[model samples]
Target: MPKSWPDQLLQMLLTLAVILSTALTIFIITLPSSYSHFQSGEITEEDFTEDDRQHAGRSGYSYYHNHRDTDGKLKTECTIQIVVLGDIGRSPRMQYHALSVASHGGRVDLIGYVESEVHPDVQRSRFISVVPIKPHPKQLQASNRLLFLLVAPLKVLWQVFSLYYALGYQTKASKWMLVQNPPSIPTMAVAQFVCFFRNTRLVIDWHNFGYSILAMRLGSRHPLVTLAKWYEGLFSQDATAHFAVTNAMARVLKKEWAVEALALHDRPPNHFQPLTSIQRSTFLASLPDTAKYAANIEDGSWRLIVSSTSWTADEDFALLLDALVDYSARAAENERIPKILAIITGKGPLKQYYLNHIQHSKENGKLPNVDITTAWLSAADYASLLGSADLGISLHTSSSGVDLPMKVVDMFGTGLPVVGWSKFEAWTELVQEGKNGCGFDSAEGLTQLLQDLFGDDGQRLKILRQGALEECNRRWDDEWMPVAGQLFQLKP
Candidate 1:
C-alpha cells in the first residue's frame, strides 16, 4: 500500500533530476557579463581597446553607444563626429543634425554640454553616443559668457585640447568632424586643430557669419568683433566644406569672406506631427488660467495670438509688445472688437526681465484690453501650442541680414501661419503675403495685419492655418541628405 520498490526507485530518480537542474540554473545566472567579467579580474580589460569598452558601465548616452560586436570585440562604427561647444538645447541645429543621423541607423558621436541628453526620438538607435564636456571654470556665473567672448580664443583652445585628448583615449580615426560655427572664430580654429590631430576632415555649418552675430551684442566696431571677423575669415580656409543656412549667407561667404560655401536651409524634425484639437487642448491646459483664454479655448471666443522668442536682443520682443499695445488701443476705440489672449512662449537671456516687465505692465493697467501670458514650454508642448494658435507672430528680422529665422520654420512646421516683421532681405523669402502669412515693417502695420488676419469670423484665419499645415509636409532629412551624403565620401 505504501508504494512498491519500482515506484520508490522512480521517485528517487526524479529528485536527483531536480537537484541537477537547480545547480545548472544557478551556474548560468551567476555567469559574468562583459562588465562583471571585467570587474571580477577574470577578463583582462587591457586586451580589449578603450573604444571597445566605451559603452560599458555608462549611463543614458554611452550605454546606447556600446561597441561590443557579437564576438565580444569592442567596435565603433561612427565615422563622423558632430561637435558643439555649448548645450545642444542651446542649438537646435546641432541637435537636429545628430538626430537625423541616428534615425538613418548611422552611429553618432556627439560632444557637447552635460545638460543635454540625446533626444528621445533618436534614442531608438543604439548607435548614438554623447561625450559631455567637462565643466568650465565658471559656467554658471552670469558674467561667464562675457568673459568667454573676451578670452574666446584661449577658452576655446582649452576645450579643443581637452576633447581631443578625451576622444583620442576612447576612439581612433574619426573620419569627419562637423562643427557648428558662431562662437565661430574659436570653433573654427579649435575644430581645425582637432581635425588635424584626429586626421578627420573638418566641415563647418555657418549658421551666420559669426562677426555679424557678435556685432549684435558687442559693438560692430569693437576690437573683439573686428578681430573675430578677421580670424573667422582667415581660419575658414581650412574647412573642406561649408554649409550656409541661406543663399544670401552663401553669397556673403563666397564674395565677402572669399570662402566657397553651399546653401542648405534648415528644416523641422520628422516628429513635429500635425497637432490635433485634442492635443492642443491638452497643451493649453498646461498653461495657467490667465493664458490661452483662461484654459477655456474650447469655444475659440478670444483670439489666441502665439509668438515664440529666444529672448535675444535682435529678436526685438519690444516690437511684439508695441504691436500688442497698438492693437489693444485700437480695440478699445471700439467695444465691438473681440477679446484677446496673447501667449508668448520661450526662455532665454532676457526672458526673466521681460516676464517681470510684462507682469508689471498688466498690473499698471497698461495692457487693459488684452491679457498676455508667457508660457515656457517643452519642445513638444511648444509644437502643440503653435498648431493650436489662431496665428503666430515672428519678431525675428534677421540680426545678420542674411540668416533665416528657425522660429518661423518651426511655426510653419505646424502649419500655423505667422505674421512676421520684415527684414525684407531675409523674411521676404519666407513669409509670403496672403499665402503662408503676411509680413510687416512697423508695429502699426503688424497691429493692422493682426486684426485683419484674425477677423471676427475667422474665415481668413482658417485659410492661412491650412496652408501652414500643407507647407509643413515639405522635406526634412531628405533636404539635407545630399549635403550629409557628401560626408561619407570626404575622406582624408
Candidate 2:
C-alpha cells in the first residue's frame, strides 16, 4: 500500500526528531569535565568545607550545603528543583517531596502548571517557591484526530520551550532536579539539556512507564508508541538517579530498562489521619450536596464508601457501575444488606460520561440501594471524606501493571480499608488482602466482597478497620526522609 503525502511527511518529521534528540543526548554525554565530575560521586555533603559554605552563602545556591552547629557538626541543607509535567497541586507525591525538602531546611523550586489550588501546607511554605509553566494552548479539538500528528509536535515544541524557560530563566539553578516520569517525553529531554548547560544532576521519579500509558490510547504496535518507548529508555538511562513507587516497578526498571531505581513507596501525610465521630459529623454536615447522605450516615442507616478517580482510561468505572447494580439487587433480596452512599471524587475528562451513565442507572431504578456522587474536593475536605468513610474502593488497574495507586495509599492513610482491583502485580505492595483491604478481579467479585464486608455481622469490618488504623502511623515524612532526603543530601 502506498502511503499518503501527510503520512510520509509525518514519518520524515518523526525521524528527524529522533535524530536531533539522539544528537543532543550524545552531546550531553560527551561533556568531558561535567560528565566525569557528576559520575565520580566525590562531591558530597560531608565533603563541603567552611570556605565552600561561605561561597555557597554568597552565591545563594550550591551543589553541596553544610552548616556547622555550635558543637561543630555539619548539617545538610540542599537546594533542589522538583518538576512535574502535570498540575503541581494534583501531584501529591511530588508535593510531598517538596514539603519534605522544605522541612529539612532545603530550598525547592516546585515547577509545574498552576491548575487546581495546591495543598495549604505547600502554599504556605517559605522554603518552597513555585515556578509556574504556561501550558500549551488547546487550539485543535479531539475531532481533528488526523491533524493530531501536526498538532502533537507543536504541543511538544511548546512544552519544551515552556519547560526550558521555566528551568533556565524563571527558577534559580539548583544542585538537583527531581522530575516525575510517566510524562517522560519533552520533560526528560529538556531536563537533560538544562543539566548539561547548568552542570546540575537529574533525578527521574518513575510513577509509571510513559509509553505504557500512551499504548493505552494508541495500542502497543503503534509507531508513536514504539518511538515513545525508545525515547523514554534513551533519556532515562542518563539520569543521576531514579525513584520508583513499588518494588515491582524497581525490579522491572532494573531488569527491563537496565536502570536501577530506589523503591520510594508513597505514604499519606500527617493531615490524612483518622477523624473522630464528632469531626466526621461536623465535616459531613458542611457539605451541601452530601447533606442527605450525611444524615443517613450519622444515624447509622447508610454506609459511606469513598473512591476517587481522574476519570482516565486505566480505571474501569463501568466495572464499578456493574458492581453497584449487582449490590442493589442483592440488597433487595436481603434485609441485612445496608444502604450505600458511594462518593467518587476527583475531576477528569470522562467524569461527565460516568455521571451520565450513573444518572441513567438511577433513572432505570437499577441502583436503588446505591447512591453515587462525584465531587471535586479541596485537600482538607477530601481527607475528611476519606476519614469519614466506612470503606474505600480503588478502580485503578495500572497502565504499566507495576505501579501502585496513590488513591489507595490515601485511603489507607485515613484508616479506611479498601476494595481494590486484584488484576495488577503492584496491588500486593499496598493492598494487603484480608489485612487492611480486600481485592476483586471482576464486578461479581466486587459485588460479593461488598456484600460480605458490609452485609456481615460487623466482625470482619472491625478487623480491617483496626488494620487500617495501624497504617496511620506510617506517615510520609518518616518514609521519605531516609530515601529521598539522603539521595538529595537533605538532612532532617
Candidate 3:
C-alpha cells in the first residue's frame, strides 16, 4: 500500500486496459447477426430448428405444423393470413374489400393500430376479425418536440430490429401473406423475402403511389422517400403479383420494374346498384345544404359538382375553381354564366388549406358565384349526388401523371362526364377528348373544355355516360377471384 509512485502508476494503467479488453470481447460475443436469412434468400432445416421456432413464435407466428397429404407427398398448408395495416379512418373501403375477399373464402386477418372503437358494421363483416395493436404511447403522439427529442432515433433502431425478427417469423409461418401499406420497407422486404424463400407468394396492393406523393409533399431528399423506394424495389422484385388501383399506376410499375403489373380498380360494394332518376332527386332533396345550393342556380346557368375524399394540392381543386371562374366570365357576357357550386366531402390535413383557398378566391373576385360546402355522406348518398349533377370534376398535378383517381371511375359509373387533368395514361386511353370525358393541360385548358361541353348540350348528351361502366365490367371483373384461388392450390 505504501509503494513508490512509479509502481503505483503502472499497476493502475494495467488494470484499466484489462477491463476495456474484457468489455469489447463480451460485446462481440453477444451481438446478433446482421446478415438476414431473408436478405440472402435462403431457407434450410436449421431455419426451422428449435431455436428458430422459438424465435418465430415470439415474433407473432400464429400457426405451425408438419404433415403429409393423402398422396404421400410432403405438403404443408399453414394459415394464409393477409394483414391490412394502416390508420382506420372514416372511409371503410379497406375494411369492405378485406371482408369481401374473406367472405369469398380467402383467409384474411386485419391488423391495425386502432385509435377509435371499431365500427359496428366493420366488426360484423366476414373477415375473421379485426385485431387491435396499440402503438407505444409515446410513438402515437407524432409531435415536433417528441420527434426531434426521441422518436426519430428510436424509430431507426426499431426498424432494424423489427425487420430482423419479422423475416425469421415469415419463413416459418404461412407461405403467403398480404401486407397493406406497411410502415417500414426494411421489415416488409425482409418479410417478403422470407415468404419467397419458403415457396410462399406475396401480393403487393399499391393503393396509392405513396413514395411520389411523399416526395412531392416533403422534399425528395427526405429519408422517407429513400425508405419507400427501397420497399418499392422489394415489392417489385419479390412479389408473385402486384395490384395497382389505376391504369396510371400499372404503367408506373411496369416502367420501374419491367414487370406487367395488374390493375385492380376499386369497385363499389357488391350491393351498390344504380338509382332511378326519381330516387336520385329524392336523395338530393333530403340534404338541407344541397337544397340551398341547388336553389342558388338561376335558370340557364350551369351547376357544377366538385367532390373528393379531401381537397388537396394534388387534387388541384384550385384549378377547378379557376376554371369555374373563367367559365362564368365567358358565360356572363352571353347571359349563360352557370351558377357554379362546389361540394367538398372528406377530411385531411389540407382541409383548412382548401377552405382558405376558396375564401381567398371569393374575396379576390375569382369565384364570386361559387359556393363550397362540406359534409359526410354514405357511399350510396354520394353516388346519388354525383348522378344528379350536370358535370363532375377530378384533377391532379404533373407529379401524379400515373395516378388514376378513383373519383373518375365513380363519375363514369354514375354516367357523369368527367373533366380533369389528363396526364394519366389510362385516362388518355379510356376517355375520348369530348366523348366520355375530357382531359386538360392547365386550368385555362380545362375551362375551354368546360365551355364547349356547356355550349352544346346535344353533343354532351350523346356522349356515352355508360361508357365508363362498360369499361369497368370488361376490365375488372370477377377474374381476380380465380387468381386468389390459386393461393390455396388445394384439390377440389
Candidate 4:
C-alpha cells in the first residue's frame, strides 16, 4: 500500500514531536541548580563540608568530602590539592605532569585509587604525593567478564544519584574540583554545582569520553549520555577552566558541551636521568619474560615496539599486525623473514582478548612470521624496554588528537626512531618524518616507510642513535609547567 504525501508528513511530524517532548522533559526533570551568584574564587574546608551536608537530600548532588587534616595546620598556605577520581594505571602522564609542577615549587597532592600494591620507584618519585582511595570491587573484573558487567552500571548510577543529591542539598564548596575519570554519574552531578559555587573552579579532564565508550560497549545509546551532556553543559557554563589532552578532544568538548577547552600537551618529566648504555642494559636484564621480548629480535630486522597499557582500544594495534603481515610477505621474496616484533605491556579488561587474538592468529597461520608478546610490567621495566626498541609506535583512533603518548616520550628519551600514524597533532609536531622518525596515514604507507628505513641502514641508525635523543631533550622543557602550577589556586 502506497502512503500519501500528507500522511507521511504527519507521521514524521509526530515522531519529531515525541523526541522534542522527551528532551524537554529530561531537561526540566534532571537539570541541577544553575547558581549564578556563587562565583567567588576562594573557599574554606568548613564551607565545603557544610554545603555537602546541606545538599544531602537533593536529587542529583554527590560530594567527595575530604576530611580536614587534624595532625598539623595546613603547612603550605597555598598548597593545591588536586583530587583525581581515576585509576593509577591509566594516569602515568598525569602523575609525571604533577611531578613536574611540584618540581617547579608547587605543593601538589594527588588523590586517586591504586591497586593493592604500589611500586617502590613510583612511590619515591619527587614533586608528587599519592593519596589512595578505595576502589569498587567490580573494577577488578575483566572487561569481558559478564557477572560484574550486568550489575556494575546500576551500582554506579545509584552511587552517582546519592552523591549528586547530597552535594546539591548542602552546597558544599571547593576551590577546584577536577573530575578525572570519575567512576559514575553522581560525581559529575556534584561537580556541576561545585562550578556554580563562587570559589570553586570545576575542571573535567575528558580522558576517554565515557559516554562514547559506553555507547560502544552496549551497542546502544545509554541514558547516561543525556546526563553527561547536562553536566558537560553545567561545566561549560560555569567552569573557570577546561582542558583536554588532545585537540580532537577539545573540539568534542566545544561542540558537544559548548565549553572552550585548552589542549594541554603532556610532556615527560625531566627527573629521569639519561641511562648510560651499561645502566640501560642492566635495567633491561631485570625485566620479566614478556617485557624482554624485544631483546629476542635479530639485529637486522626493523623492530617496532608498542608500550602501553593492555586496555587502550584507541591504540589500533590491529593495523600494526596487518602491516607486519604485509611486510613479512614482501620481505620473503628477498630471502628475508621480516623480524618485526610487537610487545604489549600493562594489564586491563582487554588483556585476555588481546592475548587470545594474537595467539589465534599465530596458530591459524595468519601472522606466522611476526612475534607477538604481552606482559604486565612495572613502570621502570616498561621504561627499560622502551630504551631497547629501535622504533616506537603510537597509533590512536580519530577521536584522539595531539596527545603525546607517554610511551613516545620515553622512546624519544632512549633515542629510538618512532614510526607511527600522523593523526596525533603532538606526534606530528615533535616527530619530523624521516628525521627523528616517520609518520604515515595508512598501513600501506607505514609498511613502505619501514621498508625504506630498513633498506637505508645508515639513515635509520642516525635517527635511532642520535636524532631522537636530541628531540626529546629539546621538547621536555618548562613551558608546560604552568598548567601544573595553576592547580595551586584551587587550594583553600
Candidate 5:
C-alpha cells in the first residue's frame, strides 16, 4: 500500500486539518458566556409589570394597572402597600420605621421574631400589623459556628415563606418593601424575587454591610465572611433604591454594587423633649444616685459628664479612663481642686471588666479628682439624665466607616455637647470642632480639651452646648417625613 510521495503528503495534511477543526470547535463550545448587568437577578421582562418601562424612576417598583371598575376602567388605588421586616421590639431603629408607617396610615405588614412579646401598649397600630416569627434554634448557638452559618440562610428563607403566607399575596395595588440588613443574607435577592412576582417595589435600608459585621465576629478571612461579602455585593444590585447610614457607605453602595443610594441621616427620637425644672426634678428623683447630683446642681462645685456605650470592642474605653486620670493630675498640679464625676451608662459583656477596673482605681486611690458611677435607666430617665450633664464623652468609632453610633445622636438630643474620642469620617460630619463638639486623637489631647472646656467658668462650654442644641433641632419625624414621601411618592 506504499503510495507515491505527493499522494501520501496530501493525505497527512488533510488529517491534520480535521484535528485542528475539532479542537477549535471544542474551544468555542467551552468559552465563558457574557452576563447582562440588567439588574434582573435571573428574572425576565415578563416577570415585571407592563408599566415598569414607563416609570423606572419609581424606586424600580412600578407595576401595570390591574385594578378595573365595572365599566373596565383602570383604578389607581391610594394604598401604599409595604412590608417591613426586622426585630422591631428589640431594635429602636426598626421601631422607628415601622411606627412611622403605621402612624401615617400606610398599609404595612411588620414581620419579625421575638422571644416573648413586646407589651401591646408599645406595639399598638391600626394599619400596621405584626407578624411574629420563630428563628431556628441553631441560629442562636454560636458554639457550632460553621453550623450556624450553614443554617442561617435556610432559616431566613423559611421565614420569607412564612411572610408570604402571612401577607397572603392577595393585593393588587402598587407595593413597597423595607427590610433591615445585618445578615444581609436573603434580604435583597429574596426581596427582588418577591417584588417581581407580587408586582411591588423594593427598598433596602443599609445599616452596615453584614459581611463587614461578620468580619468583626469571625476574622475577615473566614470562608463564610468572604462568601458573604462577594455574594451580598452581587445580589444587592437588584434593589430599586438603597438608603445607607452615611455618605461613605453610600459610596460603597454605588461602587461595589452599582446601586443608587442616598445617605439618610438618623435623627434623635422625638420623645426626648425639653423638660421644665419641676418635671426635671421629678424625673431625677426617680433615679437612685441622680438626686444627689441634682441637689448639687446649684453649687457648681462638681461638673457631671455623661458617657453612654454598648461596651463593645470597637470602642476604646481605656482612653476615657486615662483622660480622666490625666485631667485630675493636671488640675492638682495647678491646685485647681478639680471636681468631675463621669456618668457612664448602658451595659454589655465588657461592663464587668471596666467596672472592676474602675473599682480597683478607686480602692487604690489612683484617681482622686474624678469619680465614676454606672446607671442603667429606662428610656425616659436616660434622656432626662443626659439633659442634666454639663458635657458628653463619646468613645464610639465605627468598626466600619459606614455606621455612626446612635449614642452620639442621643447625647446631642439632650443639648449635651460631646468630645468624640475617635476621628472617623462620620464623627467629622456630626461634630464641628470647637463648635457643637470637639474631637481628639489621644487620651492626653482629650484631657487637655476637657480642662479647657471646664475652666474659665465654662464660658466656651455654654456656647458649645447652645450649638449642640441648635444644630440637632431636627427630630426623627421631621427628617423622616420628606424622605418617606419622596421614596413612596406621597405627601407628608
Candidate 6:
C-alpha cells in the first residue's frame, strides 16, 4: 500500500520537530549558568570528621587548598572529578585513579554509588571526597528480563537527573572529568553534556565495548543492540581524550571509531605487595574455622591455591572445579603429591549455585584430596592471602576478546604464579606462556599443567614465582603516572 502525500508530509514534519528540539537543548546547555544559586563549593577544615583525619594520617595522604612559595604566591593546579556509574567500592581501577590524583596533589571529587565498603586508602585520602549517587530503585530487579525491559528507560531517566544534580550542584567545578564506559548509555552522553556547559575536558576510560556486552543478552543483530552501538559511537567521538585497558582496544577505537586512546594497563596498588613469612602466618591464624588448612600450611604438607571471581557469566568457576576434582583423585592415588587447599573468594549472583555444585562434587567422592573453601575477604586480607598462596588460578574469559582482566594483574602484583584462561587475545598482554604465568584452554589442560607445576616438589613453581616477583616492581603508580602525568595539570 502506498502512503498519501499528507501522511508523508506529517512524517517529515515530526522528524524536523525532533531535530529542532535536539538543537534547542544543546543551545540551552551552552548558555551561561543561571543555576549557580544551587551550587556550593566551600569546604572547611571542620568539614572533615576526626575519623577521616585519622585515616588520612595513617595512610600518609594529605591535601592542601593553597600553598605559598618563598615569594608568597598561591598555587592551585589540580582539581578533577572521577565519575563511575557503578558501585564506587567495587570499581578498583577508578579508585586507583583517585589515589594517583590525590598523591599528585590533586583534589578529587569521586562520584558514584556508595554500596559496599571502599578501600581503606581511598576512604582515608584527604584529597578525595566521595560524592554518592543514588541508584534507581529497580536496580535489584535488573536480572529479571521482563522487569528490565519495562523500566530501563525510567532507570536511565533517573540517572540523568541524578548525574545532573551531582555534577552541577553537589560538586565543585573541575578542570577534567574521567568516566568509566561500560554503562555508557547515560554516562557518556550525560558526561559530554556536563563538560560542554562547564568547559571541562572529558575522558572516557574504555574497559570494554558496551554494545558488545549488550549483544551477549540481546544478540548482535537485534535492533536495540544496533541502536546502542550507534549511540556509543556518537557520544564517544566528542571526548577530549580516551584511555583503554589493552593495546588491542586502543587500536579498535582508532580503526573503527577514529578516536585515539592511550593504552593504560591495570597494575596492582602498593597494598597488594607480597607479605613476609611471619605476616602470612599471622594472616592465616586470623581466619576463622580453618585450623586444619592452617596446620598443614605450617607443616609445609599442603599447598594453597588462591582465586577470586565475581561469579559472573564471563568467569566459569566450574572449569576450576573440574580441574580440582581431577587433581584430588590423582593426589589420592599418589601420596607424594601434596594435599590441596583451594580458596575461592568473591560474592555474586551465581555463588550459591557454584556452592551447591562443589558440595555435590565432594559428596560424590569426586574430590578426595582437595579441600575447597569460598569466602569474601577484606582488601588487606585478600592481598595477604594472595601473597601467601603457592599459586593462583584465573578463570576470566573476557566478554570482548580485547579486554584483559584485572584479577590476573593483581595476582602477578602479589608475586603469585597464575594459571589463566587463555581463550582470548588480550590474555597474552598479561600472561606469558611459561614466564610469569601459564595459560590453559580446557579443564584437562589445566589439570595436567597443575600436575607438572606442583608434582616435582614445586621446582617449576618457584621459577614462575620469581618471574611474577619481577612484575611486582611495576606498580600502578609507575604505569599510571607516565600517561596521566602529562594529561592532568597537577603540581607536586
Residue pairs with backbone overlap in model 2: none
Per-model C-alpha lDDT, please? 0.69, 0.84, 0.56, 0.56, 0.67, 0.83
Which ten residues in a row are the worst by lDDT in model 5? Answer: 34-43
Q: Model 6 off-target regions past 4 Å?
A: 1-75, 144-147
Q: Least accurate stretch of 10 residues (summed lDDT) in model 6?
A: 34-43
> In model 3, where do residues sit more than 4 Å from their true spots?
1-80, 89-93, 113-122, 133-175, 181-187, 190-201, 218-228, 246-255, 258-260, 293-302, 398-400, 461-466, 472-479, 485-492
| Candidate 2: stretches off by over 4 Å | 1-76, 140-147
- Model 6, residue 360: distance off in Å is 2.1
lDDT at 35, model 6: 23
Listed in order, each prediction's TM-score against the native is 0.78, 0.85, 0.69, 0.69, 0.72, 0.88
Q: Summarize candidate 3's per-residue lDDT along 1-492 as a digit string, tens digits.
A: 699989999999999999998987865575333332243222223324465355543211122222223443332232344544445544344555454454343334455546544444455433234654434445533435435435655754555444434333322344555665434344455546556544556666666555676566566798768777766665667677766666777877788767576766665443334557676566656776577554443233547565665554567777776777787677766555455667777665567876787788778877655566776666556767777676667765535465566666666666666777787566674467666777787889977876676666635644645554454443222534444444444222
Alpha-carbon shift of residue 54 in model 2 (angstroms)? 30
Ten-residue segment with the worst summed lDDT in candidate 4?
59-68
- Total residue pair clashes for candidate 2: 0
RMSD of each: 19.6, 7.9, 10.2, 11.0, 12.3, 4.5
Best by TM-score: 6
Best by lDDT: 2
Winner by lDDT between candidate 6 and candidate 5:
6
Off by over 4 Å in 5: 1-90, 113-122, 135-174, 186-198, 328-338
Where is the poorest 10-residue window by lDDT in model 3? Answer: 59-68
Better of 2 and 4 by TM-score: 2
